[model samples]
Target: MVTSFLLLAGLGVLVVATAGVSWFMLNAMAPDVLPAFSTFLAVAVGVVTVEVFLGTGLVTLGAFLYNLSAQYSGGVEIAVTEALTGPPPANARALLLMARARRRLRTHIAPGDPGAGDRSSGARPARAQRETE
Candidate 1:
């Protein structure tokens, strides 16, 4: 119901806007030619009517198709797990900051660079890289 109402409202606004622009353009080109306001109102109403019927039909069709598919393929599976509750460790903030800084700093290393550390492994000791630098 909510989806249908939203779809109808959105498309109705679009149709009305388009009709208004067309009416404005036609009136600007030739004033007092056709009943432009009435025509614009008619077109907007007609389009919105068609949109409501088609939109509702399509939504129903989609729902039917989804139900058919779900029967064959077990639908979506959601897993829920309880979070661990406790006060964080004393050095939690410092530890997290160090990890974040290490990640950001690691991006500067080049592949196969001497004393940079094994690419397959991870960062080498500072003592090893200090002499090379």
Candidate 2:
């Protein structure tokens, strides 16, 4: 989505530059038609600018609308399973533990609770231990 917007912006700039160069060349080669050409060039640039901005605005609005609708519709679901391959690296386990700890802290810790150091004893509370078992 972001890539598409960037591409559109790049193309718009390229087209505007081309049009400006063509206008300049026309004025240089045929000074007699400069007035008429200048008027046409101004109108062309205005139209292109408006069209580009309008298109960009519509795309942005569409993305926001989709996000809002997805929030209500439960956007997407994904299922993941551990590979049957050999055990993961040691660092992988540490990273996974860190991620889980972060999630649990966010949901379980009170606003004024001391740091996670207090929970580092490696012993789950009785209720949590029971649920896991």
Candidate 3:
């Protein structure tokens, strides 16, 4: 229902704009009076019909292809979970800071050396180990 109405509304505007232009271009040569409302209505209906028919045809064709292929191989699977939406906890800022600091520490200490994953021992190469000294 929503889609139908929205399509109608969108295409109704297009029809009006096109009719406005047509009216100007044909006003001098055409009859003194024109069937403006009927012409606009007919064109609007035709536009809606074509748009719906094309959209439906494409979707049906896609589904048909997917079905034919799924007979031979397992189709793709998607997992969806209910989202958790709410305000963050009071410690959100502190948690973020700690996580960022840990990432920085990982990059700074023994980036390519063995035992690099042993940083859980709270070790670091501080400013005292700088080349400037």
Top candidate by TM-score = 1
lDDT of 1 by residue, 12-125 (tens): 988888888888898899999858597768878887988888888887777777778877899953323378655378678878889999887676665556657654566665
RMSD of 2: 15.9
| Candidate closer to the true structure by TM-score (higher is better), 1 or 3 | 1
The CA lDDT of each predicted structure is: 0.75, 0.70, 0.65
Residue-level lDDT for 102 in candidate 2 = 95
Q: Write the per-residue lDDT of candidate 2 for residues 62-92, one digit (tens) a residue.
A: 7778778777998853323456764569978
- TM per candidate comes to 0.48, 0.39, 0.32
The 10-residue segment of model 2 with minimum total lDDT is 77-86
* Candidates arranged by TM-score, highest first: 1, 2, 3
lDDT of 3: 0.65
Kindly report which residue pairs in candidate 3 clash with one another: none
Q: Model 3, which residues run further than 4 Å from truth?
A: 1-12, 32-40, 52-133
Could you give the candidate ranking by lDDT, starting with the highest?
1, 2, 3
- Candidate 3: count of backbone clashes, pairs at least 3 residues apart or interchain: 0
Kindly report which residue stretches of model 2 are placed more than 4 angstroms away from their true locations once superposed. Answer: 1-9, 21-35, 76-133
